[model samples]
Target: MSPTVASTGRVPVTIGAMESSSAASGGSTRREATRQKLYEAAVTLIAEQGFSATTVDEIAERAGVAKGTVYYNFASKSVLFEELLRHGVGLLTASLREAAERTAAEGGNKVDALDAMIRAGLVFIDRYPAFTQLYVAELWRTNRTWQSTLMVVRQQAVAVVEDVLRDGVAAGEFSEEIDISLTASALVGMVLVAALDWKSFQAERSLDDVHAALSRLLQGRVSGCR
Candidate 1:
């Protein structure tokens, strides 16, 4: 999210939002715009149909670009998909980090940071449902070429949650014996799956309603017995 390269040592990929408005020059700006179009087209096609079923021709057609342009931007479909994953998840990671930092700047506790991150995740999923669907679907598929890249970006997002959990434990806000890694994963999984359900079946529900329900679960206030 902070433009850190994966330790895989391939190349230092700059992780940022899929859409960029601050390109330094006209050529860079045009290239970013073209890449964004390709990303949007690919996400939609891959979400509607499986990745293997989608082709460069379809992506080019959907993006209203020539096949040569796809090649010029990305060497192959797999590269495009991998970069797309990096771009989309990078944006999500940045948003989560910003939420946590903003809460802390306002004198909020770790719990408040976690709550803000939950809202950030919901906002991201709501804005980019198709990309979210594609990302979640690809998370468990080991055979994909982009699996390693997905894992790296996925950890970047989860590590943000884990950092808050670790801080909470240090401050005695969370149980000392709690498993930070698994708990972070579970929290992230909860928001992702719940948000997907909200978008798929409960399309009429507002974002605040969904966030409120998840917030209760996060704060462990679901049961009325207490």
Candidate 2:
């Protein structure tokens, strides 16, 4: 006969493990949802009223969160804006990265990858015109904190572009002599200019037309054929 022992008072290991995992996942999901809502509110307010005129309280209200929640997630208005800028940049970068990955999977040329990246940027800017205005407004700001934060976010995109450009050069699809850093910055500037111009003069131009022209510009292509 097998000897039977009394059950311990502690919870079962399997049940305990499941409960912990569920609690952790639920907490993470809630945090992410809250953060997303806050980000959306911040973008909408900044776009509508410009960054300078927008207040943290307004963002909190718009997000349907207590003001303390905003402070809890972001230390200050500057930090909040920095996060917003990062989020916007992330959206564009992810779009570009996805396009690049897809092109690579199909064994497409580097120029195709680069063009897709540029087109992704154009699509993002066109979709977020007001955010573009806020971004440009921040360009002239003299605040040291803001400047540093912008530099950090700008570097993130620059690094991504540099990696892609380096790959293009390695594959012999792009000129090795081209300055990757300068070219990336120039490409970014062109996107900004085209997007701003299109939004500033909505009646005169459409985003699709601008994106087509800009894509060709980035590709160094013209009707005359090299």
Regions of model 1 farther than 4 Å from truth: 1-22, 224-226
- lDDT of candidate 2 over 1-226, digit per residue (tens): 1112124242111100112234655555566556656766777678678877889889888778899998887889888888777666666667778878888898888878777777777776766665666777776577557787777766877677778899989988888899999988887788888777776777367667887898777765766556
Steric clash pairs (candidate 2)? none
For candidate 1, write residues 39-86 as lDDT tens digits: 777887898797999989999987788999999999898999988888
Candidate 2 wrongly placed segments (more than 4 Å): 1-24, 28-31, 65-69, 139-142, 203-207, 222-226
lDDT of 2: 0.71
Residue 24 CA displacement from its true place in model 2, Å: 6.5
TM-score of each: 0.88, 0.74
Model 1 pairs in collision: none
Q: How well does candidate 1 score on lDDT at residue 196?
A: 95
lDDT of each: 0.85, 0.71
